[model samples]
Target: MASQNRVDLDGNPIKPITICMIGAGGFIGSHLCEKLMAETPHKVLALDVYNDKIKHLLEPDSLPWADRIQFHRLNIKNDSRLESLVRMADLTINLAAICTPADYNTRPLDTIYSNFIDAIPVVKYCSGNNKRLIHFSTCEVYGKTIGSFLPKDSPLRQDPAYYVLSEDASPCIFGPIEKQRWSYACAKQLIERLIYAEGAENGMDFTIVRPFNWIGPRMDFIPGIDGPSEGVPRVLACFSNNLLRHEPLKLVDGGQSQRTFIYIKDAIEAVLLMIENPARANGHIFNVGNPNNEVTVKQLAEMMTKVYAKVSGEPLLETPTIDISSEEFYGVGYDDSDKRIPDMTIINKQLGWNPKTSLWDLLESTLTYQHRTYAEAVKQATSKPAAS
Candidate 1:
């Protein structure tokens, strides 16, 4: 759906295409839906179990793009409507999965089933229907960096070759089965292999994306406000919850793990390129991340504390963070990924995409959203008297 207002790099009008966006109510999917509707003439068959995140786009038929977006409330695990939905669209995007890290160790069986087994039919339908598929994987599939195995004082740890993760070259290193933390990574790796094999033998047109900590607003939820009181969300939401409640952010294992985060909007531009130009995206596994924004978890905590204080007009707590062992924080059989920095060769060459937002700027914008969206709700939830 190329409009008069938008065109490809070659100055050609892009055709509008109907997209079957599975998991279309999650953080990434919601943003993608908004972008497509506001900018292009394309239509979306939005499928997901929950639609709260995207309700703003769905309600009030008076909205300009109301007809372009339709929501399907169903689960992929047992729904009979998934195949028909895929049949209706020219493209299918599989984003349905249990992606939280807290579930990896404690709920390994559900994790494996959600990440791997549940995705089998989605891949088969695409392969059988000859439809283009864009599947979302994770950076955890890269596991720990190569430098993690070297001695603590080794000089080669500074070399990028030893740590930077590449799509075609880096080995997928995982811990022992008993560690259990690798359950999510292992499941995701198997799904990637299956997708690659589908393209190899079945001539399926497919693309796999490995996201490295893409962050921004409407990500996950604030515990006890929009989500379960006992739920442990991804790091961004976890830290935001702590800030909103004026509680200390908890760090696991001294917060030594390092990661790079890209703004959700920046990453969405790459997806749009892929949607508009299948010639540049098919049969390739691209690493979508911002390597320039790398930081250790401890450094991230300090930065978040400062940014939250600045955004919320509140003083930082005397103890903004507390350190706990992984065993205590994540429970037994826990493990960690040492470092993750993506090699951007494939994505840059294919889509000409790059992440533009700096860490501080992105955090400021995100925390501002958090403060505005959850601060009052959290206060009300906390002020209530305890039930007997």
Candidate 2:
């Protein structure tokens, strides 16, 4: 659709605007950039240290939207260029953070600094310059459900009111300080509070997005191929790597933790609505996820195993998954959220947005892409002679 034909929720025609998208090379950022370029007429000043994931969109100046998207190679942490970038754009979207679960406990200090301290300047710049800000927070900020504290045999644990995470109602619960896994959540919560305060005190136009496990192609890198051989990515990439190598997916702590995943394409639609309709989105925290797509990690593993077999035409392994303790997988001081089902009332009432993809359907398409993109590389890598 052309920009002229685009209409806001209130039936107002949308105007083209430049967006300063920090961390535009990351998974969510890449998808947002693609959406903005392909579906909307907005220009993006894409800032990130690396552009490998978005390289497809950046090159070949002859591309239709070439002039609309420009990549700036700079880190937001200390770059003198950040403030000017924010001032030049009509809106700013901050997506930079150390978000992987592996880093939350193992690199707690870095996680805290990246999620909170580094983001302070972005919030400050947006507030000071009167630029609208869209900050991407995590569902991890909800920590654990209240029902998780109930007795295992308690019937109340089955109630959705006790377990469902609400943007406006739920409490942010975290484990003891020794459990460094909450570092990321703590930092994010603090930053969220700061942003909220800025809005309440200074009337800054802002929207906070809490994503619940948005997964799809071009997510985190596959180990030993694009990322470090020892690097541990999020669950999707982790399982995808295991499947590509024909190895058993390692389920951490019996994989009892439950998660709700929304397909990236579906989640991006909600974001676009938030972007184009600031009247409905400003001063709101939206939980963008598919609540109906909830699954236990073990269940997710099994589904992925089945889907990968179908996509790659490979036989299913007799033992598709192996259980590993949290200490062995994520190191010491690790904790996990028992369940995360976002209360969709706020987002639905405000933006009228809902996720549409099913878990199995998303997994089928995602696994197919994974197998096509990496199976050959994995085969050659494993077939190589060991260095003597």
Candidate 3:
């Protein structure tokens, strides 16, 4: 029997169990699934728009409790499909949305409606089922508090939602609303409001997680402001690929924007921790990230170059100043965050959860993964030619 706003744990009320992740195929989602499957005894369901392209990411065999998790092909926009999935789940974590800056910029309409509008049914389903809902929110919502050293409680500063955003930060501000793409933040803020309202009025358990700049494997760290097809232009991925090809790392816009990057594993762990403690998480918001480890773009490029040198057995090539001519979302010469860090005081003390993965450890693991994968790919390609 279901209680007022909480679902009973495993037919009992002690250790609440059972969870369904909406976008389990994504980077953070995949990591979260793996973490949950290993640590918890709960029945986990991983849902996504199953496609051949991302099949490896969704493979149940990759998780510890492969038999426990059920993957379903889903498009949140579809009402019936969403309703059916939401009905069977005890707890729901909606990580389905266009999360990246490139995505928000290129597909603004899809980002806005699919996240804010289409997800209405999912939230309603959680409320109706008396199950807990964990909605994924980005730190990008804390738009440009650049070098401002503003805490979570600071007055909301006006900036594009696709940039340095926070969870508690406001979506609306006084300015030429058209100048910046406030639509993305506006949409998320609207959904947050909607969920909060439902949680209060309908007695539903809902939690919001706002993650800061997170980096790791499976992250499409490519160049260009558009989607994946554009190219590998991101400093990290680009540097890794360059090392593979024995090329010099290219620094764009002098690589000055500093950002706090949370390791993929740590980020996923925080999500699972929140899910397990639904009672504490209900109707509460937490900033999930490591605020201490902040690195600038130039520092990132240098670090990648150093990592590449270790694997490639080659000296670091002299990086040259490359002019970014592309007129995409992260336009040319556009100054990004000087230092965007989070204050994890609340999450750490209350939840007793802190990011364990260090920056060096994270970067080394990333470099190693890229190195091994690239080597395997090259070996396969070259060996095939010889066999023929």
Which candidate gets the maximum TM-score versus the true structure?
Answer: 2
Off by over 4 Å in 3: 1-16, 51-64, 146-176, 179-182, 221-252, 320-338, 375-388
lDDT of each: 0.93, 0.95, 0.65
**Count of clashing residue pairs in every prediction:** 2, 0, 14
lDDT of 1 by residue, 225-339 (tens): 8899999899999989888989898998989899999999999998888888788899999999999999999899999999999988899889999998988878887998999
lDDT-superior candidate, 1 or 2: 2
Q: What's the C-alpha lDDT at position 15 in model 1?
A: 83
Order by TM-score, highest first: 2, 1, 3
lDDT (10s digit) by residue, model 2, range 185-290: 9999999999999999999999999999999999999999989999999999999999999899999999999999999999999999999999999999999999
The positional error of residue 268 in candidate 3, measured at the CA in angstroms, is 2.0
Best by lDDT: 2
The whole-model C-alpha lDDT of candidate 2 against the native structure comes to 0.95
lDDT string for model 3 (294-329, tens) is 787667777777766676566776762243422342
What RMSD, rounded to one decimal, does every model reach?
Answer: 1.2, 0.7, 6.6
Cα deviation at 81, candidate 1, in Å, is 1.1
